[model samples]
Target: MKLSSRRKAIAPATRPAAVKAGKCPICGKPQDAGYRPFCSKRCSDIDLGRWLGGRYAVPGEPVSTRTEEDDEE
Candidate 1:
């Protein structure tokens, strides 16, 4: 058997699990390869706008704004 053919036969067995191609998170439409988890440029932009507008936030302890000088004063 040819070396190339053997490699091809084994490739599928060694490959990782295929990613699920599901609906877009933004609009519930089929995802596009170009936009990925989003369906279209419009959906992708909408997601971005939400992040930039502070609609999405990561929860954490509030950061202190005062520095050493402020503490001393």
Candidate 2:
């Protein structure tokens, strides 16, 4: 009868059919809420590993490191 209780009884609007039916980017399976955009923890871990291992990189200008020896010169 209260406003808060009425709101709680209503279910959230569902996503569009395309979004709801979209496949996981990692393994081409339907995505799960727990691991959104990916199918499972294994796929999630694989993605994380790729990032940690530098397999995924952003495009940027190369940076040169200046060492103490270079400073001496």
Give the TM-scores of the predictions, in the order they appear. 0.47, 0.45
Query: lDDT at 34 for candidate 2?
Result: 88
- Per-residue error for 13 in candidate 1, Å, reads 27
lDDT, candidate 2, residue 45? 91
lDDT (10s digit) by residue, model 2, range 1-73? 5767776787977769857687677788888888877889888898788887685565566787977788983
Weakest lDDT window of 10 consecutive positions for candidate 2: 52-61
Residues 6-61, candidate 1: write the lDDT tens digits.
66565455334234656688988889999988999999999898887685565667
TM for candidate 2 is 0.45
lDDT, model 1, position 72:
78
Best prediction by lDDT: 2
